[model samples]
Target: MIVDSHCHLNYGSMTEDMDGVMQRAREAGVGTMLAINARLSEYDEVLAIANAHDNVWCTVGSHPHEAEKEPGITAEQLIELAKPEKVVGIGESGLDYFYEHAPRDLQKANFLAHIAASRETGLPLVVHARDADEDTAVIMKEEMDRGAYPAVIHCFTASRALAEACLDMGCYISISGIVTFKSATDLQETVKIIPRDRLLIETDAPYLAPVPKRGKPNEPSYVKYTAEFLSHLLDWDYDDLARTTTDNFFTLFSKTRRP
Candidate 1:
């Protein structure tokens, strides 16, 4: 079975017909999915989905885009909310220079707060770094110095140097549908070098849909295509790729209890 380690099932695109989307995921062999929270205000809805599904889990943190709005969100607040039975990760938070929707400094401060929560709670920080590779890497390294915390760069599309830096810090790398794109040759090259144990696959659904399913609203089922492409790219059997990534998800998000 495959696990979609990151997705936004609570988003409008998926929530409109979630039952159908989830049925399709099961049909496509996606046995588990983590419903990511990008806003603290929506944690209740995100957790509601997880509470109803045996295979679905959730996280509690704000995205970089919502950094300004959640400025008062402290490590203590995250730590408190994260005690929920369904919350397994600290964030989908980090720098996003591509959009810069929020001030860069605010984004960085919120990112650091999420990292602090991860350190306090022992949950993997679900990072979302965009074009600000240098600053992201530097901050991650600096934070590691304070106290090492488990983390993963979700939907990684940063430079090879940044990937190497994250790997050096023992951070996990999650591949999304972006890798299946023809123009992502650099990412493909980077994917080849990632250690199997430190690798993960996600759809980042309702956003980056893979080829053949491109331009359509993405869902957890599409993660299989990303996994299939990566399996071929890495020259490993599909089952092996699926098994290893699913195992890696469980290892990093150990707070999740499978039913």
Candidate 2:
């Protein structure tokens, strides 16, 4: 069985026909999913998506883009909010310089709060690092010095240096549907270097649909396409790849049940 390590089920597009979406995922052999909460105000909705389904779990934190608006949020607040049994992770956080939607300082502050939450609770941090690789790597390294915490660089398309930085810190790396694209040559090449045990796969659904299904609204089922391609790309059998990633997922997010 495979796991879609990250997704956004509470998002409107995917929620409109949630049952059908999940049905497709099961048919595609996806056994579990982690619904991501990018905004603190949306915690209940995101967690509800997980609570309502046996195969789903969730994270509690804010995205970098929303950082400025939530600058006052604290690690204590996040730690308390993450008290639920199914809240298996502490973020969708980190720096996003490409968009610059949120001020860098605010994003850094919010990221530290989530990192503190992860360090405190021992839950994995679901990070979203983009063009800010230097700072991302720097901050991650600095944070590790403060205290190590489990984390994964989700939807990774960053430089190899950043990838190495994450792995060096014992953090996992999650590849998304973006890897299936013809233009993601750099990412596909970067995928080759990720240690088998440190790798995870996700769809980041209703956003990045893999090829053959590219241009269509993404869903959990589409993760198989990315995984299938990755298996071939890495010269490993599909089952072996699935087992490795699934094992990595539960190991990283230890709070999840092995269904």
Candidate 3:
């Protein structure tokens, strides 16, 4: 059973014709997904999608991009929202220096709040890191020193140093469709050494579609290509690769029940 460990199902393209999108995923053998929410204001809609679909689960928190606008976000608030059984993770939250969508200090504050929620709730932190690998790794390490919490560097496209830092902290790394790009050979190389237990795959759909599907909108179904590509890169059988990642997802997001 394959799982799309992270995606934005509420994104326009995905929500517009969600049934067909989900049907395609079923047809493609993608059995479950974690529909990530990047803003607290959109929690109801995001949670609605999960409520409407048995195999879908969700998280609640603010993205760095929304950090500046969501000044009231608190670890206690996140813990309260996470009381629902379906709310299995604390964030699609973390730093994003590439866009600087939110002020860096505010982003850091938001990221730390989510980390606190993760530590308090025992739910994994669904991290979304971009060009700020150095600072992101520093914050994650410092927080771990304060107290340990589970986290996954979702849609990872950072440097090898960042990857090693995550692995050393016992955090998981989720590879996305970007690894399929010809220019992403370095990322592919980094993906090579990730221990099987520490590795997972995602499409980051309605966004970065893999090759062949490049330039087209992505969906959970598109995770098939990423998984197939990783199987080739890691020399694992397709079924075994899927099973390994499925187990990894279940292990890390233990709050999510396996179908």
Candidate 4:
């Protein structure tokens, strides 16, 4: 079975028909999903979705775009909020230089808060980095120096050097449907080098649909296409790719093993 390691099912696009969305994911052989929270204000809604689905889990962290608003958020606050049984991870956080919607400084501060929460909770940090490889790497490395924490570079689209650095830091790399894009040659090359044990796959749904499904709203069910593509790219069978990534997901997000 496949697991969509990152997605936003509580977001408007998917929430409008959440039951159908989840049904479709199960039909597509997706056994589990992580409903990522990008804003603290929507924490209840995100948690509600997870509560209703045995196979769905949630996170507690603000996205980089919401950094300014969540500037004072503390690691203790996240830890308190994350005490719920269904919340399994710490973030969809990190820098997004491609869309500097929040001040760089605020983003950095929020990122560190999430990192600290992850270190405290022993939950994997779901990072969303884009066009800010240098600073992202620097901050992650600096934080690692302070003490290491589990993390995964979600929907990665950074320099190969950054990918290598993340791997060196014992972080996992999650590839999204972006890998199936015709223009993703460089990303494909990067995907090729990722060790099977350290690789993950996501849909980042409501966005970045894979080829054949591109130019349309994405959903967790469509992760199969991305996985299939990665299988072909890696010259492994689809089932093998699915099993490896699924295992990688469980290995990293160990809390999901709870009943």
Q: Model 2 over residues 83-181: C-alpha lDDT tens digits?
A: 988899998999999999999999999999999999999999999998999999999899989998999999999999899889999999999999999
Residue-by-residue lDDT tens digits, candidate 1, 109-191 = 89989999999999999999989999999999999999999999999898899999999999999999999999999999999
Q: What local lDDT does model 3 show for residue 115?
A: 97
Listed per model in order, the count of residue pairs whose N, CA or C atoms clash below 3 Å is: 0, 0, 0, 0
Worst ten in a row by lDDT for model 1: 250-259
Worst 10 residues of 3 by lDDT: 65-74
In the range 2-91, model 4's lDDT, one tens digit per residue, is 999999997657888888998899899999999999999999999999999999999999999999887877899999988998998999
Model 4 misplaced stretches (Cα beyond 4 Å): none
Q: How far out, in Å, is residue 39 in model 2? A: 0.5
For residue 212, what is the lDDT in candidate 2? 85
Candidate 2, residue 233: lDDT: 93
- After superposing candidate 2 on the true structure, give the runs of residues whose Cα lies further than 4 Å from its correct spot: none
Candidate 4: give the clashing pairs.
none
